[model samples]
Target: MLKKQVSSAIIIVLCLFLFPTIISANTNEQLELYSEAAILIDAQSGQVLYEKNSQEKLPPASITKIATAIYAIENGNLDDIVTVSENARNAEGTKVYLEAGEQVPLLKLVQGLLINSGNDAGVAIAEHLSGSVDEFVVDFNRYLEEVIGVENTHFTNPHGLYDPDHVTTAEDMAKITQYAMKNETFREIFSTKELPWDGETWDTTLINHHVMVRDGSYEGVTGGKNGFVTEAGFTLVTTANQENISLIAVTMKTMYDNQVYEDTTKLFNYGFQHYETDTIDMNSQFVDSEDNQYKTVENIYYTKKIGEIVEEDVTTSGKLVIKGEDGRKLVEKKLELVTNKEKEKQQIKNETIYQTDDNREQHLRIIIPISLIISFLIAAFFFKQTRKI
Candidate 1:
């Protein structure tokens, strides 16, 4: 039992000391980015692969429509015909040019909002769904915070016009796009290159504003959105998939039109070149020196640099801490105790017998010596007593 206790304590200490800190960068090389705020992340694991001022809040411009589109898809009835209002007709910036009182499906407006960067379409969708732009913005912010897990975003309008309060961070926008891309309807709309527009005033093709998606600039470009305002600079969000790994890159407040794209490409190349996903299967079991079995309850995927060593530390309380090559923690999971009923029972019986045998040997060593010592002491005591008498 003493040996067993010492072994368990050593195991715990080794686990804690093996990886003292988390490794953030897989490589020492850094990408020079022109954007004020930028981030690249593994879409599946939500692990930040690279970042520069990712939490800096700036104008998101038309990329705000990405949030608007997904919110509409989830909350509004896409098939319902929305009657265009005067407010929607006169909405400023790029537009699909909807005439007042024209009947169009909510889904079509969403398509136009994303594909064309149509501010008018954004206004129409907002008004139709929430009855007013102000109310729609309230719900939009709520969804961004509570549903999408973005904290630094605040929207004053659905169209991403230059309102002082309308702003978001590159990381937050990336998170929003990541969540939106999960929906089938939103993904279809986000990646569309062009669609036929049959509006009363604008009867032409609505082409995607994102050059990367339209031109296939990259091999696996799935969807992208770019935005601009005098205050927000140039903001871009792009997602690409290669070799089964999906990545999201968001850049904000780049001074030049092309800088956002350049920063995005640099980030993407860095992630694809250096990082990889390692999956931990839930059913995989570990056998310790004592033959104790342990398994996780669910599967987890971790992103690490290529050729990095991944290690696992299982504690006595059943917590499994996973570390990357740089001694950074990648994931922690609670392991479940697995029992092989017959095998465990037999092992317990064997352990009990072994302990009993050891105890008997210990008793022989201790009892014999103590009995002889007692006999000597009693003989000495009686001799002393007789002399005194």
Candidate 2:
């Protein structure tokens, strides 16, 4: 009977240890539904929470404008006036009706492009920045490679209208949108529900293509781009925040617009509902220590919370390894918490100096005398010349 009881207790403990990991693994595996590609990401930390075929290449419709807008904002001055060229004014599909030779502020062009899905505005910005649409597209691709680090994305134009060669992965788009959101101006423009420009109001009304913005289901639904071409099917990117947690959801190749919204909503809901960020205390060390050896070091806090960890029961402890002059470990200290809150507090000790051993002191003494002798010789030479004169 005693042996059976012990065996039962051991089995229960083992099950408890393994159950959460199994559940989390299953949750990640079960995220796929009615889309060629999708990803849910934590906006603050840029951690991928869930993904399905996220790296598969697909046309990115108007979503390509995210990168276009980022490049323009970083490289081009917003106040600089961009002249509308015949090429930009007549570029096909969803135009702001810009006329050739009409000058508009670059800022307004950005607003128009993002708010109204204006293809003309995209071309205008591209041409104004790089002198030609084709040249600008080349620079745009380079920006993706260099600045954004998007390996799987290529752009043929500033506007994301379907061309066979222009494509990006769902994962790449999430990364691009995540980076774009870091810019305050980009976030402002993206989250703007409505804006008036050029005596016409570009409003995201009930009839707007993005159903997520139209229906107020998600409370802090900031802003996102929607796209569809015959080739790409329905694709949507959505950003939302709740109680300081922000999430970005991407879905591609859905059968219908509603399905795109539904899939993205599911992504956001899952992230907000199930996932949360818990701050873990990493090793805190002293900075600017005057005496590295003494305990009387004034505390100068150097603390970093480890990035997002999903499991609840996983507790972390830190070990400090102090190195000698030869880069060998001299002492190892493991931090023990007096209180639970102390783990959260990043208290560091500073103004400490290591006590010099006889070898170190001898080396310093020898170097100082040599330096003094060299200085005296230099001074004597100068003084002797002065006396002779």
In model 1, residue pairs whose N, Cα or C atoms come closer than 3 Å (at least 3 residues apart or on different chains), thus clashing, are 22-328, 23-328
TM-score of each: 0.77, 0.68
What is the per-residue lDDT of model 1 for residues 1-389, given as tens digits with 9 covering 90 to 100? 99999999999998777654323333656788898889998987788888899898888898999999999999999999999999999999999989999999999999999999999999999899889999998888898899999999999999899998888898899899989998999989888998999878668988888888999998788999989888889988999998847899999887899898888888888888888887888788865445567887788778887777898887666667889876988877777878545578899999999999999999999999999999999999999999999
Residue 250 lDDT in candidate 2: 90
Clashes of each: 2, 11
- How big is the RMSD of model 1? 14.1
Q: Where does candidate 1 stray beyond 4 Å?
A: 1-26, 281-298, 315-319, 333-389
- Candidate 2 ranges beyond 4 A from true positions: 1-26, 199-209, 278-389
* lDDT score for residue 210 of model 1: 88
Give a tens-digit lDDT track for model 2, residues 151-241.
8998999989999999999999999998899999998888776665562323333233466665666678988888878899888888998
lDDT measured at residue 26 in model 2 versus the true structure, 0 to 100 = 45
Worst 10 residues of 2 by lDDT: 296-305
Each model's lDDT:
0.87, 0.74
